[model samples]
Target: MKKDKHIDPYKHVAFIYPDIMDFVDYKWWAKYIYSITVNHLKKSPSVLELGAGNCKMAAYLSEDYKDYIASDISLSMLSGSVCKINKVCCDMTALPFNKKFDLIFSAFDSINYLTSKAKLQTLFQQVYSNLTDEGIFAFDAALINNSYKLQKVAETSGNFNGIKYYRKSKFYPVSRIHKNIFRIYFSDKVITEIHTQKIFEFETYFEVAEKCNLYVADCLKAFTYRKAKATSDRVQFIMKRKT
Candidate 1:
């Protein structure tokens, strides 16, 4: 099957805005992940992060986990990162590792970039196959309800590393997807990029996990420790390998 072309635009943005890409802040998220895993699972084990863009999360986990590996399809993004990461360039749907990890993670709604059920199924299967017995697979996805509610917002601006960025976002109710267009006005030049992501139904995740021999250990609202509500913009899932 032909891969989705939607990611190409963002890949361009990633190349241009590599310095400003720290907006996602994977360091804080990694701390939270470590706390949750240690509190619940009670062990500091090997971790593999799929779609580990910029390696911020992997850097944060370097001291916490026994081993850390960061994988992403884009080598440029990984090369420009500040973190000391053992980076691997590979597709998430076909992880190249035969050894299982104690925990696997992909954050910032990276899974939503797949844009199709079949792709997501393949990703889940790979994650399941790469996890040790009873290991955890944690990830986040955009929520359809929140995407629809915030569809018509106008452009917003932010400044990073002396570069001014104008960002505009639109949501498609029919497809439950959100598209973000960014215009970066730098001292040297102006660049534009578009990013597309799907807002998946909460139930759809459970079904996908079932097909991959995984089960949800917990689901929570993104950026918070609270339980996920219907109106939440992002839903974080902690899945356990069933077999």
Candidate 2:
């Protein structure tokens, strides 16, 4: 079967919102991830970040781990990232690494791009196959319940150096998808990009993980180590591969 074309917009818009990643509190999130993983397992070890984008989270988390490998589908997005990272270009559903990581993770709802059950299962299998015994896989997904919260908001616009960006998001309740349009006003040209991502229920992730032989160890609210609630906009889950 052919892959979904929804991610093409992300490949284009990634250039405009490269700086948006800096808005994330990597230190706090990294500490929370480490705390939960260590509480369930043990100390920092080797780590792999799938769909790492142009973010510093992997680099921050790498301080505790012995080594960090960052992989993303977009080479341009990876190019904008800062860090002494061993970057690889590969699809998340079919990672190129072998069983080399104690922990594998992805953030910013990157997994939502998978958009289907089959692709998600493939991604989970890939993650499971690349993790060591007792290795953990953690990732975040946007919640559908929170999509309506921002439905009526006005369009937000911003600029970074020479690139100006205009963003607007619309939610589809029936399909649980968020469609985002980004209009980038560059020095000499204007470009419009549309990015769509499917939102999943918290329970859907548990089922997907179980299918890949990964059990949920902990599920936390976005940006904090606190237990996730039904209304949490983004849910972070830590899953361990059962040996």
Evaluate model 2: give its lDDT. Answer: 0.79
Worst 10-residue lDDT window for candidate 2 reads 4-13
For all the candidates, what are their Cα RMSDs to the real structure? 3.3, 2.8
* Every model's TM-score: 0.84, 0.89
Q: In model 1, which regions exceed 4 Å deviation?
A: 1-10, 15-25, 40-44, 148-153, 158-164, 184-191
lDDT of each: 0.78, 0.79
Question: TM-score of predicted model 2?
Answer: 0.89
lDDT of 2 by residue, 1-243 (tens): 997753433565677665655566788877877776765545667888888877577777777875788888887778877888788878888787755688888888888887787888999999888988877888888887667776877388887877889889888878887888888887888988877788877788889888889888888897786899768988888888876
**Count of clashes, each model:** 0, 0
| Candidate 2 residue-pair clash tally | 0
